[model samples]
Target: MVQQWDIVKIIGAIALPQMGGWVNGYLTRQEIKGWYQNLNFPSFRPPNWIFAPVWTSLYAGMGYASYLVWRDGGGFSGIAQGPLFLYGTQLALNWAWTPIFFKRHELKWSFVELAALTATVAATGFAFFNINKLAGYVFIPYFAWCSFATLLNYKIYKLNPESTATIEEVKEPKKKTN
Candidate 1:
């Protein structure tokens, strides 16, 4: 039997991760269509159309997993603190990846970030599992996807070495003071 507050928590939990992704997507939209389109992706890279649906599903799953962890581990109480912290950390890393990769075009740095994100995600999953088995289990697909994405990022970094070069900033002419 689910209570009213439970429903609210469930909705809130699920929406949180999705919201992070939305913000990142919104910020990186221009780069996705422009800079990202020019990248040399691996043969295994899926079509652009696949990313939205796949990521949406993955975010939803991760949200639900967090909800389970929250519910089963005793909300924000001491017991849930560690797992939730890991969740928040991974979520932040997840949000940071797109802008780093797409907008800034920092291929190598983005790959490094993604690798860290993957490890943090794996740790979070394990922590969630300790709280609730289902919560841990729900992270499987996310972990798998992250692993795949890490490989893809690595390949992109390798294939596009020129992308990693530091851009020389052209200084504006010194303004003449009145």
Candidate 2:
């Protein structure tokens, strides 16, 4: 029923977003150089190396799930579309958090954003389960990762309350001192 080209297109669409998200995560790592060493992370926090492999697998699963949903068609109207949209939105939010937290160094803002991201992903997973069981299953790891990330964000925020100040405000003091 489905052509090979259609499958390719679906894979492309899904892969592009996932790739962007992957890149975003990597950029976040670069932006947060020395972050782990500097911060008082929780004992349960996984090592920095673990994030790469886990995220790589999660992104691959996301791409596959998107392909399955694409094969079904109907976009948002399709059974999987609801989850797809939710997934997409959360991914976009996920990408934004890196820039906010790492580049901007707004830990509190990042905390709020991560919370929203966690909630949206959970909702997406729930929606996906109602439509495609496999697709829903694929998102479980992503959801778990987000949950862990949320806790990390919360701890970071609490540990560094003043870290939330805007760049302009935080930088002004340094400029004056110099």
Candidate 3:
């Protein structure tokens, strides 16, 4: 007998962060061609379209693993609290990266955020593994992806140091008083 805390809930937990991320990604995608996608990439860059499915699958894995922890690890009271907190922390960091990199066009700062997100995910994985080996192991792929992303983010930053958006420069000067 599956309870309320089943696959659907797990998927929902996983999807929540992704939902915010996708909105940011989609809203900024139209401007990406001249801004981000065409920037010089490392030789190891994967084709662009691959990111969608890869992220989708990874999100699913994240959801399932978190569910296992929530269900099997005593529902955030005893052993589950630590891992869940770490998971939520990393998830927020994960949610922030897209908007920073894509919408704000802050490559160097985005790399910084990616570095934090990668580290947070690693910490979450350790906490989760301590609670449930499967839960912790599930994050391994996400950690790996984030690790790769750190390098990719750095490469993009190096490749286009001049392309950062200048919000301050875009602001209009105050009009002279009458």
Candidate 4:
């Protein structure tokens, strides 16, 4: 039996991360059929169909984990501040990566950003664990996914040198020597 306030908090918590994903998904959908389809991904890159479900699950889990932290740690004031701050930091980084990679086409920079995101997520997980073990446990898959994403980002960055080239450079023809 859950209280109305608890339900509201859970919904809010879950919505925040999912909203970020929705925005990022918008960016991804815009490019997936065009730019993303043509990009040079690593051999280990997962099938395109797999990403949405995995991400949805991870986001929901982390969001619930956050709610636990907020509830157990006594809201934003007191002990919740540090962990919540960490969660916020990681969420921002997570949101930033999609725009950087999908919209701006900055593969290398996105990888760098993702590496930072991975580290931040790990820190957030530890912080959440300190506050509530369940929160920390829920973060395990999120951390693992971030780690995998970071590696995938690095591999994609390496495989696609042309990703950095400007549109002008791509469209221009090279002259042949006699």
Best by TM-score: 4
* Higher-scoring candidate on TM-score, 1 or 4: 4
Select the stronger candidate by lDDT from 1 and 2. Answer: 1
Task: Give the 10-residue window scoring lowest on summed lDDT in candidate 3.
Answer: 165-174
Query: Which residue pairs collide in model 4, if any?
Result: none
Candidate 4 lDDT, 86-171, residue by residue in tens = 99999999999998898778888998999999999999999999999999998888889899999999988888888865555567
User: What are the per-model numbers of colliding residue pairs?
Assistant: 0, 0, 0, 0
Q: Clashes in model 2: which pairs?
A: none
Model 3: CA > 4 A from native: 1-5, 170-178
Best by lDDT: 4
For model 2, the superposed segments whose C-alpha errors exceed 4 Å read 1-3, 34-36, 76-80, 174-178
lDDT of 3 by residue, 57-97 (tens): 87777877777788777987967888888888888888888
Q: lDDT at 48 for candidate 3?
A: 79
Reference-based TM-score of each model: 0.91, 0.83, 0.87, 0.92
